[model samples]
Target chain A: MSTPVQAPEAGQATAPRRLGRGTLRFLLPPKVIAGFAVVGPMEGKGPMAGYMDTTLEDTYYGERCWERTESKMLKEAVQQAIARAGLSEQDVDVALTTDLLNQCVGSSFAMRSVQVPHVGIFCACAGFASGLALAASLVDGGFARAAVVGASSHHDAAERQYRFPTELGIQRPPTAQWTVTGAGAVVVTGGDAAGPMQITHATLGQVRDMGLKDPYDMGSAMVPAAAETLVRHLQETGRRVEDYDWVLTGDLGRVGSRILIDWLKERHGIDIDGRHSDCGAMMYDASEQDVHAGGSGLGASACVVSGYLFKAMGRGLVNRVLLIGTGSLHSPTTHFQGESIPVVAHAVCLERPGTR
Target chain B: MSTPVQAPEAGQATAPRRLGRGTLRFLLPPKVIAGFAVVGPMEGKGPMAGYMDTTLEDTYYGERCWERTESKMLKEAVQQAIARAGLSEQDVDVALTTDLLNQCVGSSFAMRSVQVPHVGIFCACAGFASGLALAASLVDGGFARAAVVGASSHHDAAERQYRFPTELGIQRPPTAQWTVTGAGAVVVTGGDAAGPMQITHATLGQVRDMGLKDPYDMGSAMVPAAAETLVRHLQETGRRVEDYDWVLTGDLGRVGSRILIDWLKERHGIDIDGRHSDCGAMMYDASEQDVHAGGSGLGASACVVSGYLFKAMGRGLVNRVLLIGTGSLHSPTTHFQGESIPVVAHAVCLERPGTR
Candidate 1:
């Protein structure tokens, strides 16, 4: 193997001269004219009763877990979002999508059926926020007139790839949340109309290695990184906890959510009491939802924000929201390294101009 | 499990209202400010002998493959493009990236190491043009001021996933091209600058099944899709075959290239003989570069265009260029369905205003 080479220092010789900026710059920004969400059919439904179940038998790719079941959920979510935004497929200039599949199977395949110009994205669970940031930037930059950001996840599919099969009787940790098999999408356009909220500012956190292991415990793995990024975003954008009516994270589950709240108070001296919640926790309503934790990348938070919260926003139940997504930076190596998992986070603040 | 509920129609009743026009909008159009390319250490000197060596180690992760190895090369190419663009990481509003990894491991992980706001994307091999289209739209929609589009592919990594391990002596078909383990990135920004050309328009093709079985034979799997999208783009934009100085596809190896050309002529009657080329064919000298069929995804076309062609444009070697990325819509199920592989294509046109 070639000797490990060092990445060039900022402004150093041998470094690409223009790579000095530590952050992305925006020439234009997207106005969130409207957004929509679709909750997956799996929510409220019991564990996908295995391939033997009648529903599973029908949807399964001939009884294979790798089949494209998630595509259906994704398409539904996107269609709902587009409709909510009062836009047609023809009006969408770009489709920015991401998912948990290895090569973005959900988004790519979903777009195949939708027939929209698409650019699939992947950032683990953090993809939703990252995609939103990009779409907003694209709209702000004048590169597109309108765009869509979407993501999805399926428990049966994720379990097969990341853990033991359901029939194997593997013990899932209390912190491990069932991967929600659902999809959520939002439409960002340049011109304004009545919508839930306008995306004010988006801040991205750098990937940091806090040295956590165990990809299964994504909440614990991601909390520190999520905390760091959320704090940094508030600082960089010159916003404070009080500014947002609600501060939300994608899928921190019950365990991660508590840890995050504590971290915010102790580390950042921020208090997020009633104003803070989690998509993971809200998706199934702790009691009704069997997912021990709350939500994860696929469609957990996406459905809540787009379906429940967005609907609420449209009805004038809520006015402003700050959505942050957390992702674990663990790869097969990180798992093999016995090293602590690194994590990343991104935040997008949304507000309605004339809402309460 | 819930039974498969019928999906709502596009304009079905009870659907959410769409956002009307005249809403607040942001538009930032991207201009090709500059571009560059750089061959990384893995290019000629590495554990793998030259770029054709079947074995390579992943930079971020261990265990070598053509995919990860090529990703490192694409990273260097992107660095060069950023340098040529005369922009820093901070200048980039969003770093839009994609690759062929099941989880987009190369692009997402590599992006964490970079300082830009990373948004990893995927569309299989079609990622290059898809990214360009999205980036350009971001610029045109006023979402970002400047952005970068990147893609990469590796032989070692891809081979292990698609076919027998290098350790296993396996016969391969000539139609199968070794995935080029390389990376390429391009910087797109708003406003004018000295560069090859401005991106005029981008169009995407629908995914269609042509009943291709072997995942290795991507050329045949993708040719039809490429033809359909390219023709549609031309017709929609009201441009004829000779409008572009050059029209290129991502990686249609010799066999697929011929097929695509023939199909285009037969189907669209728009002759693009000398004007058309493939990134897969151009990346290496046929004899010297053991890439039998051509490159796929990853940095295949992006690297070539940004590194080689962008540089040529800077030196006044060329003026206008049209890049098209083709992707194979082959899922594990396409094989099961006894279906032919469907293909999809996306295209972006770039040109120097004054010179052209």
Candidate 2:
């Protein structure tokens, strides 16, 4: 059953003053009550298939269009997350969600059925972290008792908008990554009721342009952003690479993840080789799947972090974790105009109570 | 000049835990230090032209591409705003900005030049208030000392993506609202450094659909959302319609504002006649500009509020104000699919010092 949330007393305020300049030190961190993932057939068949709550036998998901299917998946994810938390839509105070579609169509349309307060945000692939951060802020600031954060990305829909249509079946580049087809949803509340899934701190990142115009090589373009956020988060929070049980990136793919590792070591002397892993690389079996670099999309990081990691943490297998969400901000028009790509990353500290 | 920000002591913690359910009570409401607006020649010739800091001789703004021009205007608006605040980009903790372009290209790219932390949000025409609301939260929650909110829209760019190309010169319907060509920027900071421009409360809105499918007639589609938020805000804040010196709505255009006013009186027994005005209606003279119903876009509301209203508050010409930002949550594809348009409205309560 759902219950009202209250802020922790002054004496219970455990966090240090807001870290650095752009970090939120949640004195009473919000809890992740439940999470759910819905993936397409290909993604369901991948290495991370077991983590998903539902996987469509076909990409259409019985919808007429791929965009419609995306909306369905997002709505289902929200419903499943609420059901898992034993709460109904009526109990939710608000929903913070977004996707890659123009005007955030997927989030707005999908969430319309719920009828709760909502705000469709846009942070590109970093949407998952952005939604989570805002949801946590809403809960921590006592604006909502329960805030739902959701996002989705469909291969069919994304391909035509960002690249070529699926009907073309154009030859793919080795550097290009597959857009994961799925949706992820999480229910965030104020307190430690959801024990192993507490959100303690957040570091919002700035935009970084790297002069890479090729959309296919987005992985390469997103490296600086991931590294920048990681360094700032570590420095501001007084945290070391080893402090986290796992440091996960949104969708850096194989190439970008390696670049991040190398850059961190060279620039900050911070080596996270053993402790760091990327959602993109973890989404599929790189060699077996045709996805050249790895899997990437808003869904990749969201599904992995919420579906896979939440269960892992619940089993006491993993404890403290840092999720660094990376997004390459660009439009087809901007790219066509020969402009550089702008990227960003936001990091959130999640942990089990025992680990803290 | 630029100083590191610190959280205030206990006595200075003047706000409640948070405002009403849907509102964020900024214990330490962030102050609007400065704002700037830049517009195209068409908008410069309108009624609100004097509110703009600069009016371009042409929509091209000396850029090769019209979209590039939009980016330039946004960048200049931000730079002017920061300078007016007596600071530079380095002094900014973060920038929360967005625009009408796909993937928020304009804001992200223009903001990359600033090199501060950036969060590209997308809420359609609600972007200005969305940006300001989030910026205020970042400051109030101790995440940033100085935050910048920016947004832009170019008529040529919006026409091409949302409708036919500018070259097409298609005849628009009477209900169609013209997208404004301009950008607006506001600098926000924690504490009350800018005494006359404090943001006190915010009410995030929910998605509302009235089964309207025409994209061109967005004003009619957005009326329900505007009314919903206005009523909720008034109910929660326990304020009468006359409490505010002004109640401004973002780009509902001529037709939508009339519908909103009628609905308010009929549904809530609230008559906001003389105290209220729509940014869309004020941006242009419907009879003279041939903008159909009126003006629409993030730039419309953003410019009026940040540029004109900020100055008014500073000079004691206005005291209490409520800005309700409305957004249409639909895309071209959604319309093609015959889906009903979804709309949203967010309200931010702003005031001059000594009113609290």
Candidate 3:
């Protein structure tokens, strides 16, 4: 593959951290010092039960509204992450966060108490990975010493805002994935910090839309973006599928996950059969949880990586992991307006230090 | 004031770029190579008419829906800015954009055609400042050689989403500000690039809430945040108000602007009388436009800076400018839920290189 190059502007030097067009190879890898996840009662009953830091008895999580519940979960996750890292609120530099709610109020309200400088980012479900990549870059570049990156989604909040209200008892199609009622936060510190996981590389995705207007089947609409970013990351970094111990994708459920495998093989001749697994698919037991396809939302991948994967890494169960967070960028208004869903995916590589 | 310092991690050197808790002192300042603005007919008829790159005869701008119009305007702004920079789409590294829309669809849709890696940020109207700071840091840190940062807002679109439908034509209170139908894009390159304006410093703001719940009186809700960021920025950078030729704020309109001036003088003992101006207040003539307070939106400060302010700078009318983009972070849902408004403001310092 040819290297993506631009005409050098003025005194520009080849940045040591930038590997390709959109891929960043950090010279001083940022360490993920701590991770925390909070989920609802339903998610606590799922396969990811033991990995979660806190599980609420209900979706409301003691709050009056689902939105406030989301904000609380996000706040708890971030506070827990910082605490687990042996740092206080004043020790962190910034909080980069986002959620599925309108205007991303979940993050804004949550950060009101976290009290650090807040940078609200939006990539739909892919927000966690986007935040992670940006936070890692900031730490590696010395713009921040430590950053708390998080994302959250409440099932009831997503249902009412993006689809039918929970009280309406609307029937979702088989292709529809359940929005995970959870929040996850990761504390990323600079290279000097010792941690189990290090962020070594990142690849930002481009917006990809193929005119798919079926909002119920977000999986189908998002496959192209997921495959695009995954392929680009591998190609740009000159790495093969086998190089990674786990190729983890965000909330691309059953259909999207299968399609991604086929698309990557057909389009780029990449084989990722055993190494690839999806956070959405892993979130719930197909038969027991009534979630049709699986779990989805900004919180799905976030919870999986921050809760399950990081814990696994600490136990030496995994070393090299590539997390690709996928998002379908569509709102109810856009769907009503007959606009197709635009999708994006961002990839971040996490490795145990000295794994190579 | 005590210097903001954290316990340095293992093998960590004191980063030369961090000035205070949230302020960044860019070692190699990013240059603003080009800027482009597109405004609706009403805005074109206002005082900023001559500086705008494009003016639409109607709000639709030839599009069928208001949302599409916003997306179109954002796309045009980014394209025009890139063109003005004498670069192709391939020359730019990424597009950092956001708008006052549900899930930030305005930016996602616009970037679908821009074909660059997209980073969507949300801080309500303060998004332009957030994007600029992130883009500047990315460029200065060598992760990106050049980046395009932009923000957009449409009057009807924002009105319908955030408040009463425009078709209802509900009477707005005197404290309400007009949402500007406009979009602006700025091209920022690495320090090696030669340009008229240079971004030397940035301060990311924390979420500030004074328990103000009035959706109509957003100016009042946001004043605390504006004051907080401005004070923090000045204190962190060790610069006085007089150091800047102009201290420009985003969308604080008439009432909030007055509150800010009085509040700063009373609380912080800093006088910014003659050097201060609000983008929203400057956009329209008080007598002719009939906008009760003034303009307010993500596009308000964006259009003013990319259109009028940059042009003024190029012509040597101003040398040092401090841009504080402000946002009231409460959504219609949050307002409906009886939650108080959370506000944020990010400040960016721009100056002519030789003058500094």
Candidate 4:
């Protein structure tokens, strides 16, 4: 969509300016040339009983007992993906990686260890999908031969940044999801391949401000934006909500997922039915895992790109997937703007070979 | 370059591997597609003095203060460059931007304000040139039609993060130069244009650990890397130091500049003669300005891309220009290792239409 233009000056202070309609055109389309997933042994560890099941707790030795460092996980994931693609570092024209951290430390530090030139990206949870979209655009524009998109999360590290120490008796929110400590990587190139999935299109949602105050409660904060972007993607691509084998939203826990579904149906007349799934929910067995919700930015990103999604592709259980990432655009300034929190989102459509 | 591999027994420990020469062949040559430079208001009216001079005191805010936030500066610079290239935001398939901040907050935050999907890059002072190199590779590989590259810095914000406030009487070495608080942006695309300059090739230098420990003193810390990259570019590209009408290093204050010249002559067997210059030196009056060295990452980036280099192009003072950016790759881990500092550099060659 083209950016709206400001209305012509009427020279009247009392009249409001009319908003111009934005233009929509495809400059680049999304496509997946390769994919990779990596998991660390430490990520599977469970938290202490009775502690907030949704948050990772720091243990002795300055490390989180329940989660691994996202940077380490991401490096492994990206390396494996690169190796699997039978492409050397030099074959990668660009790299887009992101994670939940103060400044995408995971992506930045990971790039340092790789030989390929890279750039770090961040859009909160939506960052991974956005990275994929951007990478696909580069490939479509003929700017990159192969690009890698990766994301990771470390539960222990993220908890400390969002909440108090484990010792602090903070009330747990039902909507809160435990961050899965994992990483996922994907390699995208031009031309046809044996891979089952290909990206068809992508759409980025405008930043929307909806008053969500708590930084830790991201599910509630990002749901609205997620819905907005998903609808926009379907609209822009002329696709229907039921066209995909599965519709996935990154990191939206049970509560946020419900909210998103309801909003989509009510506002956009799009009912996703049971085909809609949440990556966070699928990352772990909630009943056995004790996670109230499922996961966070890194968790959702890693799980969706690596876990069931890719596995399904391999087994041919799913032919097409629509992946949407939601992000909270909260900053010190936006926080100071009162209780409202702003959010951004992006969506990418992937189709299996031989699928219409 | 291809990564070196050594066969070893299953039980044998492997030694550190070096990059193989064959790997270098994969990198496509870089070309300059579009460039822009802007000089912020500089009038000795703010908190400090020595306005417009590269040699201002480390704490001088007046002469070098950027009128807008670092984020705004990057966005505007990038927007203008893309517009000047007669391309819309969608034309940029990949966007790369960098800064000197620890977290790359400037680039990250600035990207949030733009409609273009982008990734944040970090290479310290060498970021500007490195960005160009990456952009060119993307274009050459046919992954993107055009890419946007930008770098920005803010003295007030950076100072607080690096050391004690100016109020603290911290001793500084003579080799230190003040960082310029500004930004510069360029748009690089494929296809021929009426512009006089074209990017020829770009080369990146290895990150060298020079064992320099002082972060406050960047000039001395970055000279070796700059010299190494410059020499390597000349050797690899089969271009003599005198081939270009001008050879500009982003920012190597007075002291570092002298050291660089001496080092180049001693190690590379090439003397640039009077053709060599530094953007830091050109930003302001050297002696009168309090900046012992001219500027660091931001200063050099802003001054060259915006102030002097672009002006030179406009005035037709020089048809061909070779710009080199030198960066210190220092981290907390290196500090613990008792390593002084490591530096990495990148070089970009630009030529007028008829020169090459």
DockQ leader:
3
* lDDT (Cα atoms) of all candidates against the true structure: 0.63, 0.84, 0.88, 0.61
Q: What TM-score does the predicted chain A of each candidate obtain versus native chain A? A: 0.83, 0.95, 0.95, 0.82
Better of 1 and 3 by DockQ: 3
Ten-residue region with minimum lDDT total, candidate 2 chain A: A1-10
What DockQ does candidate 1 score?
0.20
Give the interface-residue alpha carbon RMSD of model 3.
Answer: 0.8
Could you tell me the TM-score of chain A in candidate 2?
A: 0.95
Which runs in model 2 stand beyond 4 Å of their true positions?
Answer: A1-17, B1-15
Which candidate model has the greater lDDT, 3 or 4?
Answer: 3
lDDT per residue, candidate 2, B68-112, as tens digits?
Answer: 899999999998999999997878888888898888888887878
Candidate 3 per-residue C-alpha lDDT over B1-356 given as tens digits, one digit per residue, 9 for 90 to 100: 11112222232233477777668877778899999999999999899999999999999988999999999999999999999999998888878999999999999999999878888999999999989899988888778878999999999999999888899989999999999999999999988788878898899999999998988888888888888998999898888887888889898899998998999899999887887899988888899998899999988888998898888878877888889999988889988878899999999998776554
| Model 4 agreement with the true structure over B57-98: per-residue lDDT tens digits | 333233233222655666667777787778888666667787
lDDT of 3 by residue, A117-156 (tens): 9999999988899899999888887788899999999999
| Best of the candidates, lDDT | 3
RMSD of 3: 5.4
lDDT of 2 at A34: 93
iRMS for all predictions? 7.8, 1.8, 0.8, 9.8
TM-score of chain B of 2: 0.94
Better of 2 and 4 by lDDT: 2
